[model samples]
Target: MTVTAAAHDGGIPAPAPGTAPQQVTMSGAINRALRDAMTADTDVVVFGEDVGTLGGVFRVTDGIARDFGPDRCFDTPLAEAGIVGFAVGMAMAGFRPVIEMQFDAFAFPAFEQIASHVAKMRNRTQGRVNLPIVIRIPFAGGIGGVEHHCDSSEAYYAHTPGLKVVTPATVEDAYTLLREAINDPDPVIFMEPKRLYWSKGSLPEDASPDAQIASSFGRAAVRREGIDVTLVAYGPSVDVAMQAASAAMGSGWSVEVVDLRTLVPFDDQTVVASVRKTGRCVVVHEAQGFAGVGAEIAARVQERAFHSLHAPVLRVAGLDIPYPPPKLEHLHLPGVERVLDAIARLQWDDQADALHLPESSPACDSPASDSKGGAA
Candidate 1:
C-alpha cells in the first residue's frame, strides 16, 4: 500500500454559520468523530500501532497526535495483544480508550483479551466496573489486500456476548456510529470496511459530531425503498447491494436495500418489516457464507417473517475459504452479478409453486394477494 502525507488538519472542519452541507470522505468523517469525541470527553484517548505519528495505516487518525498531544494519541509497540491489554488497563482506571488493530487478521492475537476481559468485564464484575472501550478493526476484502490484510471477521465478534459490533457503510454513519461506540458503556467492536475508507458523502456543514445516540444507534437504515425484494447488507457490501438495487430497476424490480449498521444490536424490526413488504429477501456480505452474519440474518428473517415470505431467504456472500490473493479477490467477493443472481432466484412465480404447495391447499394463498409486484 502507498503511504500518503497527512493532510494539514487531517479532518474536515465545521463550516461557518449559514454554510450548506459539505462533502466528507469516510476516513475524514471518522477522524472528525475521534477529534470531536476526544474534544468533548477528556477521558477519551486514542492509541494503537502507528496511530499517533503516522495517523494510522489509512490516516484515519491523522493529525490527532499533533492536535491532542502525544499523551492522548500515542502509538504502541507493534504488538496487537499488548495494545488491547493496555487499553483494558486504561479502561479499568475510568478512561475511555479507543484502540485500533492495524488490520482484520492482525486482531486475532488480541481475541482472548477482547472476548474475556473487554467483553465480560461488566457481567463478570456484577456491574461494578464497565469497560467503555472501542476496538476499531479495518476489515473486509475489496482493496486487493493480501491474506493477512483482508478478512471479514465480523461474525466472530458478533457471536460473542457483551460486545456490540457495528460496521458503517457510509460517510455519515462512519462518523455517527463511531461517536456512539466511544461513549457506549459496553465494549464495542467497530468494524471499519477498509475498502470504504475513501468513499464520500454529504453531511450538513454544522453537523454535530458529538450528537448523542438517543434512539438511532442500532437501527438499520433503509437506503433505497422498494416493493419487490429486500437486499440486506452492511459495511463494504452495502455499496454492492445498492448497485444491485440500481441495476434491478432496469428489469422492473424495485429492490430495497437495508444497511444493518449495528450487527450485535441488530434491528430485526426494520429488516423483518422490509421482508414482509417485499415478500422476498436476499442477504449480501463479503464474509464467507458458512455460518457468517448472512446466515444469522437469513434465519432471523425466516423465523419472524415466515408467512410473509413468498420465496425462501437467500444469501450472496464470499466463498467459504480463505480470502483470495489480490488479483482474484474480486471473484471471491460478492458482486452485482452475484447479488442480482440471488435476487432472480427469489422465486417470483406464484406462491404455491415457490413454496412447493398445491394451488388448492389451504396454506397456499392466492397469487393476486401478494404485495405489489411480488410473487404474482
Candidate 2:
C-alpha cells in the first residue's frame, strides 16, 4: 500500500500531558504504539520470526497480525539478515517496516544488513532515499534466562554512525518512543529491556503531542536532579541507578539520575550539565565493562566536565565474561549494591562530611586511562 503524507500524519493522538495514566505493562504499551501506528498509517508493516501467529517471543506484537491482517503484520523466516534486508528494501520503496529481533543476540546476524545498508543508505544516497525502518530487539539481563537470551548490545548500535539507538525505561516512553521511531525519517534501533516487559506504568488514553515523549534525538532525560553525585544509566541499569540513589539518600547524599533514552547521538549536554552540578558521576549499564556504553559516557563526562569533577568518573557495569548462566547472572549484572559501592568510593575522603575527591588519581586524567571503570 502507498503511504501518503496525510495517512502517516493522523492517528489516535497522544493524550495531553499529565492526563489519566492508562495503567499498562511496558510490553502492552509497545503493542499499543505499534497498533496505533499501523492503524494510522497503512504503509506501516511489521514482520519478524513468529510475530504473526505467536505475537513474538515476548508477545510484544501480540494480536497485531489479527487486527491489521497478514499483509500488514506477518512473520518472516528465521534469517535475521534476510529480514533486515527485506525491511530495508521495503523502506526504500516508501513503506515503514518495523522488524523485530527475537532476542538481543539474535540481532547480531542482522548486523551486516543494518550497519552496511540500513544505517548507511540515506547518507550514501545523500538524502535521495531514507530508510525509515525500526528494528526492535528485546535486550538486557534479569529474566533468569540463559546467556544469549539476555544481552545488552546498545553500545554496538550506538557506536554505528547512522543508526539512532533508543532504550525506554518507563511505560510512558515505551509507547511514545516507539511511535516516534516509526515516524522518524531515519532508521532507529529500538532496544527494549526484556526484564521490563511486564513492568507496569500509566499511559494516556487520548493522543496529545505534549503527552508524547519528546523525539529529541541523542538527548538524556533527567529522571531526578540533585547536587551531590550524578548517576548515568539506560535500560535495565536505570532501575539499579535509581535504587542506588535511594540508598545513598539514607546517608544524606542527594543523587541525580540521568536516563539516556537515546544512546547514539547521546545527550552529552544533559550529562555534562548534571555532572557539573553534582561534581561526581557514575555511569551504569547492563552491558559488559569492555567498550560498553558506560565507557563512552565516562569518557564524555571527563571531556566535558573535567574541571568540575570532584572525583574521577566511575562506572558500574557487567563483568567481562560472557553473560553467565541464569543462576550467576546476578553477579554478571550490576545491581544497587554495586552502584552504592561506587557511590561510597565517590564519597570517600571527604573532610567536611560532604562528597569529596581523593588526591588527583590517574583516572582523573582520561576515561581511557582506567579500564577498571571503562567497558568490560
Winner by lDDT: 1
lDDT of 1: 0.87
Across 144-225, the per-residue lDDT of candidate 2 in tens digits comes to: 9887788888888988999999999988788888888998999999999999999998765553322444566677889988
Please give the CA lDDT of all the candidate structures. Answer: 0.87, 0.83
- The positional error of residue 103 in candidate 2, measured at the CA in angstroms, is 0.3
RMSD, every candidate, angstroms: 5.5, 6.4
Runs of candidate 2 with Cα error greater than 4 angstroms are 1-19, 208-213, 350-376
TM agreement with the true structure for every prediction? 0.90, 0.87
Minimum summed lDDT over a 10-residue window in model 1 is located at: 1-10
RMSD of 2: 6.4
What are the per-residue Cα lDDT tens digits for candidate 1 across 93-175? 98999999999999999999999888899999999999999999999988988998999999999999999999999888888
